[model samples]
Target: MGAEHYPPPWFSVAPMMEWTDNHYRTLARLISKKAWLYSEMLAAETIVYQTGNLDRFLAYGPEQHPIVLQIGGNNLENLAKATQLATPYGYDEINFNCGCPSPRVAGHGCFGVRLMLDPKFVAEAMCVIAANTNVPVSVKCRIGLDDHDSYNELCDFIYKVSSQSPTRHFIIHSRKALLNGISPADNRRIPPLKYEYYYALLRDFPDLQFTINGGINSIDEVNAARLEGAHGVMLGRAAYSNPWQILGLVDSAVYGAPLRSITRRQVLEQYQVYGDSVVRMYGLKPHIRDVMKPLLGLFHAEPRNVVWKRKVDAALLRCTTIKSILEETLGEIPDRVLDAPLTEVPSGSTDTFIKAKSLLPPPYTVSEEELL
Candidate 1:
């Protein structure tokens, strides 16, 4: 199917490592049917070498239909093989990871944001990935890296990749990655987010679709970005940390779908059934503790949340099933909190959006030097 046939990538959850796994995605799907979900970045070598164990790495529930599988690698052959291996899993899209700034990924692995330094290689890699998969192809990348953080340089990267490859969608993280000897955590915080660079891409590459990512938290902010001409907006830590608040409102607030009539208690009960089935079938491959990890944040910022969390911690040690965990801890939280429908909408801050607009760079134009 063409990109026009699919649901617009209006809002999505970011592909966070370790956190945006199958279990969390199952929970996220239960909350918002419209929000696009992303699998954690899997290395191409991991998929190529683990051919016998493909299901363990690439398998996802049928409900994760609109999901995208993100893969990272510097080699062309492995990228092709990985895309081929992942194609059978029915991912809606295959995204190349060009934005990860971790030392292990960008520094030693020589992929991720490091790939941005070589746009020709990225264009070739995208072509290889497109050749292998039946689904739409995309790249998730930082605006620039270190000394290359400029509007023209960012435009050059976008222009070459789009012009040379079949890939049309780009997810801009908005911040330039600092490759200096800093922790990955600091890379997210220390480098200031330059949303102007992302907006400028929209102006320069009118035909290519772009999704703005990084630092977007609430549903209100997601709406603000869409209003500001962003094709899409992605949420990272906020969505994981407060799935109820973030994902709960996505259907109604973001997609303009009907308000979800379900409550947290209903969500927990459904998740309980899923957890039991997986534990019964998989055994300790996904331990009971791992299955329950996503539930820890379901009651985020609610009344008696700490007490409920303490009960959850106590239950995790002895509980064998998700049912047992809920039975022991659910009562610590009141029915009013548990049974209440998600009605309150957070009033998000617009200071960042205002600042970004002020810093908007001039519309990109072909200079005479480039025209020659």
Candidate 2:
């Protein structure tokens, strides 16, 4: 293993902003203990500001072991300080966010494939974090940005940033991030993914650990990626939606890693425990709504379970009490979410339905300084 090993060829929860918060991570761990988890990408500046209550950002149940904290920022000193604050919470690794294409991130001067243009800074920042923290420091990045489409440029950029001195593992989201007025949603779909590019990273730079991310939604997609020689596969939304599908089977399916058996009902019950804890601790934020969303996939196939998911959906959308929502929608918690948002599927029309990506925010512009 590189630094520490919990599962071979680890899987990760991509750093989605509001979606992958502590509440969701806790719910996810209840589904799969071994799939590596990460916090939503936090800026070094944000961490410094929140260090007094570092527990807020760093608080994870002990059961969620081998979790990595994903952080962003170009300043080496701030990165080092943030890494120090993170270690006490027992992060297995520290990851720098070089992939996100948000304007807020760009306004602060970080993320986007913009960080790749200055691999030297990324390299030094990694060096500082790796030096200061006992935990491993890694990077999650895109191939390159809008104008830098040439595969050669991306390869050269990775070679420069891998900084193979110690921990040379870099998670490559094999697509270009177009940071214009265009949203982050389109960036994932619009940028043509060359899986060949992922395999090329392994062949060209065998010394570095290359994990493939982006557009990975299913087991078949994951298997195809492996055939291309990716060290590991990373999932963003799919893993979130089908946590059990990936985590429940991934241990056996992908890595021959240890398997844990947890049924669908069992998973839902576990989430309830988490849901209760979240309400007790953080009050109502976003995850109350998210926990309800995943349950929809559970009963989608079964006509009866579909009602439960729909009940959950109504409650979640209304931001109402679980008891009240259950009573109102399913008459008895219905057993699962109706498998699709009631508003969308019940009406079922493109013009009326807000698509999944609509839930995601737009891409950010990189400031001139970050471009440098």
- Which residues of candidate 2, in runs, are more than 4 Å off? 1-3, 164-167, 257-261, 280-310, 313-372
Candidate 2, residue 99: Cα displacement in angstroms equals: 0.8
Assess candidate 2 and give its lDDT: 0.67
lDDT string, candidate 2, 28-66, tens digits: 777666677878888888888986667667787887766
- Give me the displacement of residue 275 in model 1, in angstroms: 1.1
Q: Which stretch of 10 consecutive residues in model 2 shows the poorest summed lDDT?
A: 344-353
Residue pair clashes in candidate 1: none
Please report the TM-score between candidate 2 and the true structure.
Answer: 0.80
Q: What are the per-residue Cα lDDT tens digits for candidate 1 across 129-236?
A: 999988899999999999999899888788778878998999999899999888888888989888988887887889999999988878999988888788999999
The 0-to-1 C-alpha lDDT of every candidate, in the order given, reads: 0.89, 0.67
